[model samples]
Target: MNNLINIFFLFLTLTTSGFSQKPTGVWDAFAFGAKGDGKTMDTKTIQTAIDQCHAAGGGKVYLHNGTFLSGTIYLKSNVTLYLEAGATLLGSANVADYPITPSKYPTYGGDLVTDKMFIYAEEAHNISIAGRGTIDGRGDDFNGPYLSPSFSGRPRILHFRNCENVQVRDVTLRNSGSWVQFYQSCRNMVIDGITVDSRENKDIEKSRHADAKGRNTDGMDLVDCQVVRVSNCFITSGDDGICLKSLSPNESCRDITITNCIVSTNASGIKIGTETSGAFEDITVQNCTVFDTRVDAISIMTVDGARIERINISNISVRNVKGTAIFLRLGARNRTYRKNAKAATGILKDILIENVQGTRIGGYGCSITGIPGFLVENITLKQIRLRFDGSNKPLLSDDDTRKPVPIAPPAVNHTVPEKIDAYPRGEMFGRLPAYGFYIRHGKNISLDNIALDYADDENRSAIVADDVDTLEIIGLKAKPSPNVSEVVQLKNVRNSPNLPKSN
Candidate 1:
C-alpha cells in the first residue's frame, strides 16, 4: 500500500498535463451518479468521486461537458478536480445546501469573515482544481449591501486552509456570494490563467452604486499563505480585485509574487490588508494593468499589528482611475486576532514602487501617511507618471465612495479627521491637500523621476510633505495649481534640498 501511494504521488507530481490528454487515473463524476443537469443536487455524487479518488492514492476527479450542481464538496489529499471545456460546477442557490465547516487553521477574524464555502479543502496536500472550465457560485442568490462583507449567510467558491502544494489553474471563476476564493494558511500554491468576474454590477458609474447581486465578492483573497505565484489572469470585481491578507499575526504571508495580470474593479485593483494581524514579507508585483478602478490602483495598508516589509512593485499602467495611483497607510485600527486579545498598530515599511504610468486619474492622487508616534518607514517611488483628470470627490465618512466633485479645492481645515480606528481605504482621508502626492507622518522616504500633471487646471499643490524625517526628491516634473506659488508644498520636512541649511 505504501509503494502504491508513493507511485500515485509521483505520477501527479510529474504530469501536470493539459486537458486534451486523459490522465491515467481519472475518475469520472458522471459514473458516480452525478446527473450534471444543472438542476439536480449532485453534491453526494461528486463527493463520492473525490473520496474514491483519494482512497486510490489520488488522481483526477473529472467533471466534463455539463453543469454539475453541487453544494459543499470537499477536496482531499493528492486529488485534482479537473473540469473539461464547457463544464461548470455550479453552487446551490439554497443557503443550507452549503454546510458550515470551520477552518482547520485558525486565523484572525475567521468567524467574522466567513466559514462557508462550496468547494473546500482543509488539512489536505497536493490538491489542485484545473482545466478550462468554470465554477459559478450563483452569488445573486445571496444578497447583501453593496461592497460590504456579509456577516450573514454567504458562500465562497473555494476555501482551502492548512493545505500545501495547491494549484488552481486555467479556470474561470465567477459570481461568488462572498469572496470568489480564499486560500488561507496554505503554502506552495500556484494560481495561473484563472479569470475572475465577481461583480454583481461592473459599471460603477451608470448603476449609481447598486450592487444587488452580491457584495464583497472579491476576485481572490490570499490570506496568510507562502510561496505563491499568480499570473496571466484577468480580474474584475465589486471589491478588491486581487488581495492579500494576514488574518493572524502568528501566520505570515511570505514570498508571494503576482505578475502579468489585467484588473478592473469598483474597489482597489490590488491591495494588502485591512485585516492585517500577520506579517507580509518579500512580496512582488510586476507587469500589470489596471483600469476603471473606483479606488486605489495599488494600496498597501496595515491597520492591525502586523509588519509588512520588502515589497516591490513595478511596470504598472492604469487608465480611467477615479482614485489615487498609489496609497499606503499605517493606521491603528488594531482589531484583535482573537476575542479579547490585544492589538496594536502595525508596520508598513521598505516598499519600492517604480516604472508606473497612470492616465485619467482623479484629483485625490497618492497618499502615504502614517499615524502620529508611529511612522511608515523606508519608502521609495521612482520613474512614475501620474496624470489626474482634475475631477475628485473623495469618499465621505458615510462611505459614499462616489460623490460629485466641486470646481476646485475646498477652503476648509486640512482634508480629514484622524479616523484612527476606522477601516483603512484609499479614500479614507477624503480629498487630499495636494493633487499629486500627500505624504505625512513618514520617515526615510524618497521620490525620484516623478511626473505629476492634470488635463485641466487645478487649485492644489502637486506634492505636499509634512512631518517627514530624512526625505529626498529628485527629478520631479510637476506644475503647481494656479493659486499656489510653488509646485511642492513643504511643512515640517527635514533633510532635503527644498529646505534651508538651518531651521
Candidate 2:
C-alpha cells in the first residue's frame, strides 16, 4: 500500500508539472465554461492555462466575447490579461474563493488586516491588464452583514504593488469595495482614459472610519511611489477623487504629475494627506476640473508631525465647493505616523498655486496655518477667484488652532548670504515673495505674482503673516470685496525682503 501511494504521488507531481509547463494561446487552448454543461466551472482550467503560459513563456491570456466568472487570477511576469471588446470577466461572489494570500497590501494606522485588497500584483515587471471589456470585482457582493458595521465594507477593485511600467487605459472600473485603484511602491505607472463610479454620496464625513460609509472609495491612491501620471480620467466617488499620500517619514514620494482630469469627489478634489509624513516634491497637478466636493477643492495639508514640501499646483478650477475653496493646513495633528515624534516638526513650503478659480465656496476663502516650531512658507497664490454660498456661513476663526507655539527666525539670518556662508541652500522655483507672503521661524521663503480676490466683504484679511523670517512677496493684489479690511499683513516680520504693491 505504501509503495502504491508513493508511485501515485510521483505520477501526480509529473502530471502537474507537465500541465503547468504547457503554453496555450487563444486558438490552441480555450476554457469555455460559459457553454460547457452549466455546471462546468472553468476556474481550474483557466488557472492551468495561465500557469502553462507562464511556465513556457509569458503571453496574453485571452478571453473571448463571453462572461468568464473567475476568482482572483494572478498574473505572472510577462503575462497579460487581455479581453476582447465584448468580453467581461466577472468576479466570483464567494469571499472564500479569494483565500487570503500575500498580495499588495498597504497597511495604515496600527492595523494591517483592516483593509485587504483583491486583484493584487506585486514585485512584477512589464505586466499589464488591458482590454476594451471589463474586469469587474462585483464589489457589491461583499457589502453587508460581514462588512464593517459602522460604515460599510471596503473592497479594493484593482491593486498593484511594487510593480514597474504598468499602463491601465480604456477600462471601465465600477462598483469597487474600498479604493477603486491603488498602486503602492510602484514605478512608471500610467493611468489614462478610465472611469470610476460609486454609489455613495459625498455628504458623509471624513475620518479614520470614512471607509465604512457606502462607496467610501478613493478613486486612485498612490503612496511612496514615483513616476506616476494620471490624466483624462473621470472619478466621482464617495470620498476623495484623486489623492496622493506618503506618510512614512523615512521615505520620499516624488516625481508625480496629474493633468487633464475631471473629478467630482465627496471629499477633496485633489488632496495631499493630513497624514503626510514623508516629503512630496516635484508634483504637478494642472488642467483639471472639479465640482461639488464637501471639503477643500484643492487641499495640501501637513497635520500631526508630517513634512510636505515643494508641490506645484497650477491651472485647476472648481465649481460648487461645499467646503474651503483651497486650504493649506500645517496644523498639529497631521502626523498619523510616530516616526518623527522626536524631532522638531517640519514645514509645508514651496507650494505654488496658480490660475485657480472656484464658485460657491462653502467655507473660508483660504487659510494657511503653521504650528509652533514648524512653518507654512514659500506658498504662492496667483490668479484666484473664490465665491462662496450665502447660506450656512460658519464663523471663520482667527484663533491659531496649532498647539505648540511657532518658532522665531534668527534676527541676523539675513537674506544676503554673507559671502561664503549661505543658510543651508535649497533649490526653489519662481521668485520669492516680499510683503504679502508671511513667514515665522522659517528661512529661505519666497512668493511672486500671487493675486488674491476677496469677494466677501464681511471677512478678515486676505494675507496674514504673523512670525516668520527671510520672507519675500512680489505683485500681491486683493480685488475689491464687500467688507474686507487691510487684506494683507507682515505681522512681527524681520529680516525680510521689501513688500510688493498690493493692488
Candidate 3:
C-alpha cells in the first residue's frame, strides 16, 4: 500500500512535530522586579521570575495586572505560571512569610503539619497554573481550630509534591489558610475551570482562644493522586467540598474524575476517606450539583486502613442537605503502620449510585454502615430520589397527639452495635431506626428505582435493614407514615429475595 502510506506519513510527521513546539521562555514578572502594588514583597521577585524561566529553557512565568503579595513561591521544571486576567497572587499575612517544610512522609502519629506552601512544588514535571488569575489565600490572617497549636502555623495555598504533568486551569481560588490545594504525590492532573471560594474570614471575631470556623478550608485536597480530572468546578467550602485522600501507606488514589461540580459545603460534598492510608480505585462522580451541604452529599469512607473499591456516582443533584444524602462507611480506623501491628481490615467493595436526586435531607437519613465481620460489599442504588423535611416529630406522649403514633414495639433483637472502633458517622448510630434508608452491615445490596418522600408527619421507617445479606429491592416507593405504620423495616435480615413489603 505504497509502503504503508509512507509509514503513515512518517508517523503523522513525528506527531505533528511534537505538538508544534511552543514553550520557549516568556518570563515576565514585571521583568523580574515584580511590584504589582499590593504592598511590595513579591516573594523575591516571583522567585526571580521562576528562576529565569527555569534557566532559559522552559517557558511562561508571566503575571499581568496588579495585587501580587507573595510569601513562599517555588515552582520549577518546565514551568508555566501565567496569570493574566487581573492577576492577583496575594497571600502573606506574615506568619514568618511561611517557611517550614516538615513532612518527610509523616502523617498522623508522626503528626503531620507540613508547612511551606503558598504555591510550592517538589520533584516537579511539566507544571502549570493557568490564567484568569486570583490565588489569594489571605485566609483570615491564619488562626483556626485545625488542631490548634496555631494550626501548623498556617500555610497551604497550593502545594504540589512529587508532581507530574499537572494543570490547574482558569484559577480563582480564594481565601484559604490551609488545604486550599494540596495535591500530594501527584500524577497526570488537570483541574479545569476552577473557582474555589473557601468562604473567607468565617465571621471572625473570636479571640479568647479561637476554636472553630473554616478550620481546614479544604477545597481540593487530592492526596496520593493519579490520573485526576476535576472539571468545571465551583466549590465553596469551609471544609471538604472536594476531598480525596490516601495518604501514602504505599500511594493510591487511582483514576479519578469529578465532573461538572458545583458544590457547597460546611463539610463533605464529595469526599472519600477521612485520609485512608492508601487504596481507592477507579472513582467517578459525574454531573454534580450539591447545595448548602453541611455534610454528605456523597461521602465514601474506609476509615483509615484503605482499600475502597471502584466507585461511580452519576448525575447527582442535592439541595439544602444539612446532612446525609448518602454516607457509606466501613470502620476499623486502624490509622496505618502495618507490618502486622494489626492494621489490615479495610475493604468496601464495588459501589455504583446512579441518577440521584435529593432535596432537604437532614440527620441520619442515608446510611450504609458496616462492621460485624465487615460486610459492605457490592452495592448499587439506581435512580434514587429522596426528599425529607418531615419535621421529625416523635415525642408525643400526652395522649398521643391525635392518636396513631404507635410503631415502636420491635426492640428485642439486639446486634446492631458493633461500632468497631467508632467514628464512622451518620450520626454514629444515634437515633437511627430508619428515617429513609439506613441499611446496616450490608452484603450484595441493590436498590433499583427507589423513591422516598416526606415533608411533614414523620415518625420513622422508610427503609431499614439491619444485618442484611443479599438484598435486592426493586421499585420501592416509601409513603406510609401517618405517624409510622411500617414503611419497610426488617431487622436481622438474611438472604433477602427481592424483599419489598411494608408500605
Indicate which candidate wins on TM-score: 1
lDDT of model 3 at position 251: 79
Clash pairs of candidate 1? 249-277
Q: What is the lDDT of candidate 1?
A: 0.82
Which lDDT value does model 2 have at 119?
62
Ranking 2 against 3 by TM-score, winner: 2
Steric clash count of candidate 2: 24
Q: What is the TM-score of each candidate against the true structure?
A: 0.90, 0.74, 0.37
Cα lDDT, model 3, residue 88: 90
Candidate 3 per-residue lDDT, tens place, 261-324, comes to 8988665689887778779999899998988766578989887778899899899999876557
lDDT, each prediction? 0.82, 0.60, 0.76
For residues 1-503, write the lDDT of model 1, one tens digit per residue. Answer: 99999999878864542222344689898877789999999999889878878977999999998999988899999999999989999999988887755554553354533355889888899999999999999888886554444345678888888899999999999988888888888999999999997876676664425645436778889999999999999999877899999777678989999999999987789899878888999999999999988778999998988899999999999997776789999998888766666675689999999999999887666889998888999999999998886633333222344344332445322655676777877666667778888888999999999999888767778888888898888899996777777778788888776553322
Error of 3 at 274 (Å): 12
lDDT over C-alpha atoms for residue 192 of model 3? 93
What is the per-residue lDDT of model 2 for residues 45-162, given as tens digits with 9 covering 90 to 100? 5666566667667777677656767665665667676766777666667665555553334354423332344466777777676777676666777664322321244457777767
Clashing pairs in 3: none
Error of 2 at 272 (Å): 1.7
> Each candidate: RMSD to true structure?
5.9, 9.6, 19.8
Q: How close to the true structure is residue 296 of candidate 2, measured as C-alpha lDDT?
A: 61
lDDT of 2: 0.60
